[model samples]
Target chain A: MTFTHQSGTAPASTEASVPYLRLRAVTKQYPTGGGVAGVDLTVAKGDMLVLLGPSGCGKTTLLRTLAGLLQPDSGAIELDGQDLVSVPTFRRNISMVFQTWALFPTMTVRDNVAFGLKMRHVGKQDRNERVARALELVGLTEFADRLPRQLSGGQQQRVAVARAIVVEPRLILMDEPLSSLDHRIRVQLRAQLKDLQRGLGLTGVYVTHDHTEALALGDRIAVMDAGRIVELGRPVDVFARPTRRYTAEFLGLANVVDVSADGGGYRTAAGARIPDDVIAGRSDVVAVALRPDCVRLSQTDDGGTPGVVRVVEYQPGGVLHDVELTGGARLQALTPVGLSYSIDTPVFVTPEWSKAVPLAD
Target chain B: MGRERVRYPAFAICFTLLLLVPLVVVVATAVNPGAYIKFPPDGFTLDWFTTAVETPRFQSSLLLSLRIAVIASVVGLALTIPTAVAITRGRRRLRPWVSTATVLPLITPDMLLALGLLIMLVQIGMASSLIGLVLGHVLIGMPLAVQVLVAALSGVDENVEQAAQTLGASRATAFVRVTLPAILPAIGSAAVFLFIFSFDNVSISLFLSAPGQTTLPITMFQYLEYNSDPTVSAMSTILIVLSLVVAVVLSRLGGLSHLAGSPTRRSS
Candidate 1:
């Protein structure tokens, strides 16, 4: 079968589109203070919500809570408009692909895939057929009889995915499933997984510390920091208009300028007042974040901030210019390689105002 | 790399000689034509083996010991596998206590446990019977079984069990299907230890066993105390050979060293 993955978005036919799952103020806490605290979100059917964050940021805890591995302390979890707060894990009809691919070492690949079906008491013939189909779905039909140890790491991960999807669960949880893999393998598996998720039209919750993975794979991304979601939105929206400084800086390598109002616009550290519509009050101190792609180097463009190129480092596809402003503050910008200027060379750095976002405290 | 000719250390050679000298002497004394404990045999013969088999007292005692050891080991296995699993899979706080408690049998003095059992068994009117002997053996053997099992449990990748659970197997199913197979070698080692401990137990049987219920070790003690003969030497040699056979068999299944107290063993 051809791989199919429809880009998840708010469908036009809202009347027919229902949420697959919903977490209503779900809060999970441990005695040690390391758990998800008061999370509220709804996942549309077939939507992949990627919980992206640093380590110990409650992404895994949230995923576990969703999977019923850990119950929320004081909130309701609903599946298809039905309350699942009291439901046992096995009966939750939710599957989880653990961070460590937990393949049974003794059982054959086929048996591992067949396990959930057997648990649900599927008949012998039907279970065998579904197992074969599941293996084929993961492109492991020829490896059905092999033990997990016999397969490569990527293959074992695929088996885990297959075992999860074979049950046709209402929702699936993956906890940094690709973090343990080599970069190349991770890329390959991510694409394969996205395709499989779309083809199956399964709702998924993926947890990872990798912002790139979140950007590339999620229909909606939730940027979590210190057990709370600092920002959650479409990947483009969150990256383009981060509501919090941590979210903005975390999504990419960013450069920030502490700006104060001067005249009709904001004056940067270099005393250059860039034009903007957002007003700053006496109590409001603002930081402006600019992505590298939004900053351009100019040797003679007198319209922008005047600075001296203090250092230039050659990167793989580009060269990074560390420009020192008149006030002794520094800003970094990446330009294509071979676009050159010597250190101590006079230059003007221009920020693309359209790409600049005023960060929340 | 240069081909290096390795030489055995002097201490290693001395240790090997120190252990082997008595072993050789015991074997020689067992087969000696003269019915006495001697380093050199007057002539080679199978008379001791024949004598050991034909003597009803020795034969019955051997059977009793074998039966007691087998029962104790099997019972110990039944208790240890589940307890070890519970302890390993338990909540963090419960785990430490359960683990330490299971090993309490190993840490406590054997004479004290034997005495405690003796007092309890006498109150229950079970002392000086095969049941009492079996109970004594289990008390001595269980800790070994638990130790071996815990070591085996530790070697298993917990991810394997989680995988099974996610694949629709219940926690119990995952244990039977995944955890059990991974720890089979550890279980084997535990079984061997339990059998050895049960077979060699003296204090427990001293408090528990009646005249006919005496195990081979107990009977050997009685025989050695009465008469200094080649019979006791022959028995000790046989027990040593049995131990070696068990070790070889276990190693064949998987290297026994892997099942021994590996660093990973402590965690599980």
Candidate 2:
């Protein structure tokens, strides 16, 4: 089987001019518990790489390693070419925003944002200027004198972001900073964070479990699983053509169809023969997978499998209608906005051959 | 069958009666006009109060006890806070053992610990003195402080400290800036408990107090043994009042009872 990058896909941009930080085969093991496995990553200056995975996947550990909070048991970390493996977290010239917002309860917002500058012994005039700029960036200037407890959760999170950036460190790390916010606040802050990252040209390593956030915020996204980075590429590429079966399944729920090797191409479980030209065997498993959006419904006479609509869910963006075919295999179809469809309607479900790729476990 | 009610009023009345007996006797003895102890006074006067305050021995012993208690508690807090933080900050494997070791002092018999300390001090040529007494008080005070600090540290959001570290604060700085403030209420409660333990320490002081370094409890014990007079009652009244004042101060500082009343003093 041959592998191919689909046509009309946008080519990834050239590498960033200056490499801000590089984690060379970094591996962290707890001796008593599992931690991040071998991780090879290069975060360029002004680049944002979001580590996306579920809990216990070690995305947080990778971010912490970058911030020098937790030292990698193996491999070297180079910051702007100089090895920072042994450098302490405080001296790493890196800042991090935690999931908890971590604003200093004793200090007002001003002080919390100014703490990094103070620790670095920044002059008072310059410190004030940077602190004010950061607070203004986060739209928290009015709450500068308020203690952290006095601010709302979103406001506190913004302050945490402001505090990390106030010192204008070369790199910033955020571990699910918006995960604790309400849905509305999360949506609002996501746009704000993207705007801030662009405005400041900040190099950031953001760890998150949400794919939407990862796709929206990260220039390059790394999907991790079981302590290892299973897939890493541009957000679009990772989403559109995942390298591993795990990657395809994790990005979104892809309907996986097991196929057996036939004389020329392959045969679906239902004994339907598929030609070789369609199955781009990228993985070892003899299964073809397609996104729900790829599965289309039409009249049975129009070269589609006979099926009955089992369930119809009207989502905000589209209607997700599941079709149970005569062969007993279920397929889901995403009918876009303004599409007319109803439950229990007899329909024909056909998989989009162009996007279906062979899957592996 | 429905559960039987607790009869809270009966319990409250019994508790009040039990506590009122001592308070009433102490007040009556202090006000009695008689020079000696009596159940019922001929008349009321404040002579014993005046006499108790004027006594140089009582005044000196009180001052010495206050000084020892203050020093001991301060030292004990210094030891406990770091250990508590260490316990809270340690790996999962180490956390349990460290927490258990810190609280072991509270579980062990105070008399046995005091005897052991006295023997150790004597072996080191540190005889009964203010320093030895202070050390003994710290031994008794430390468990209370640790218990309080551990509870306080446990209540502190670990994420806050981790956030601090992310925001350019070192572990120590993060603790001082974030963890300490969050746990200040617990620390305040701990301080009150250590103060009480140190101020009223009898078993440790009995073994450790020097001739001139006698603490208030030691002096009170001596006076009670020698003569069951109204003066002792006056002293007890003063102690009760002092304890009440401290309790109020602590409550104002941090709602100490709320913290102390928790079943899990040191959260795992």
Candidate 3:
């Protein structure tokens, strides 16, 4: 597997540059056998690194460990050149926004936001000013005096953000913070969270299962599977050129075709000749994966390999056709919404050669 | 709908009347002008009420009962809150056993428990003393306190306390500022329940109380065995009124319905 740098952004700084937060060999093993396994991650100052994975993939475990809520069995977590593994949660100088919003229902929004300041012995006047500013940042100034239970779900989440940001800790950790909101509200809050992080120059580690959210929010994305990170790179790089079969399939970009060397050229399992440039410098290429978006379909069987349309799925702006080759292998291709084809329609499928990614196994 | 409404009210009235008739009779007997305990008083008089108050035996017993109840409830709370927290937040494997141990007293026969406690106290040379009486009451009241507290703690979101810790509050401070207030209503109800159970208890008090440490209920039971005066009626009425005050206060604080897991009604 190889990575194509489509986004043209430089990679994260190496350890010689003194990253703001550094985690080395963090490992926490649960009795049930699926926990964080020897994870090493680093985040530069004012950058957001998103831990993206499906549920039970140890993404939350990693975030919680960073927040000091869970102790790694053996690891060194350092922030600003200070080791924090032995520090208790309260003294870690970190803030977390929970998925459930976790606001104190008994206290009004103002009190909830001021709780951290009060604990740190911040003066009353200064605490009030900070709380007011935090609330305004989240657009929740008018709901300050109301109890958390009295607010809507989105409003409660905003109050949670205000409470987290008011403390102004060294780092902020968010665990699927927008997972509980409706899609529309989630999109709105996502933008707000991104802007807030950038405006304040906050260093953060966000965890989520949504790829779209990761792409939109992360300066770098770490895609985890099982208990370890399978791929880590810029969002576009990871999405377009996943380094492993699991990463490719997990990111919904797998259209793997078994190929073999036939005489001087490569042919798929269905005996269709693969263009030479697509298999360029590889003598040991056994299979290739193409993204669905990179495959094109035409109604006439004159341009490329011929297949029958098996299923047509309607997406928001386009449609996907599952085309079955004569060799009994199926592949999906995307087409414009104006083009509608019934199942069993004979069509030709062509994979854009430049976008074909070679697979190892 | 109209017929159903009328039928509901009718049933409620009948049920309420059945409960109120005996209490009315007791109050009527207390106010009787005659010395003997008779309903439909010959004339209204304050003699029985005054007599019940003036009696030295009743006075000391009332003080003893109040002291015992307060001590028992406080001790019960001290023992049960940690137990409830452990049961709620500890390992999943131990939860079932912890729950059973806390609720054991509710199903065990009081006489059996009292007998065991009496023997234990006697062996320890603390029988028939204030300490022995309080110990017994605490045992009986602990189950009630633990049950209510466990319910309240389970309803609380654990993340709120974690959030507090990340906000610079220590573990102890987080619990005091977040978990404690969240379960305050349940604690209030449990205290009231422990107090009432200890104050009105007779069977456990029977084995635990010495000659001078007799509680109000034990004293009243002994008095009723010997005399037929209206003094006991007056004492019962006073106890009933005290309990009513506690109930009203508890309801005003919205503790009762909260313990039952119902949404509390707001008074306009």
Identify the leading candidate in terms of lDDT.
3
The residue ranges of model 1 lying beyond 4 angstroms of the native Cα positions read: A1-17, A260-265, A278-285, A298-317, A324-328, A341-348, B1-17, B93-98, B123-125, B253-268
Q: 1 or 2, which is superior by DockQ? A: 1
Question: Could you give candidate 1's per-residue lDDT for residues B206-260 as a string of tens digits?
Answer: 8888866778888888888887667777777778898889879866544345435
Which ten-residue region of model 3 chain B has the weakest summed lDDT? B259-268
lDDT of 3 by residue, B1-268 (tens): 0113434578898999999899889988999888799978888888888899999989999999999999999988888889989998999899989899988987999999899999999999999889999989988888877887887888788898999999999989999999888888888878887888899888899998987788999899999999999999999999889988998977765555555764321111
lDDT of 1: 0.79
**What CA root-mean-square deviation does each model show from the true structure?**
4.2, 6.4, 5.4
Where does model 2 exceed 4 Å of error? A1-18, A273-275, A280-285, A298-303, A326-328, A336-346, A358-361, B1-21, B39-42, B255-268
User: Model 2 - which docking category?
Assistant: acceptable
Clashing pairs in 3: none
DockQ value of candidate 1: 0.41
Error of 2 at B91 (Å): 3.2
Q: Residue pairs in steric clash, candidate 1? A: A116-B167
Can you give the lDDT of residue B111 in candidate 2? 90
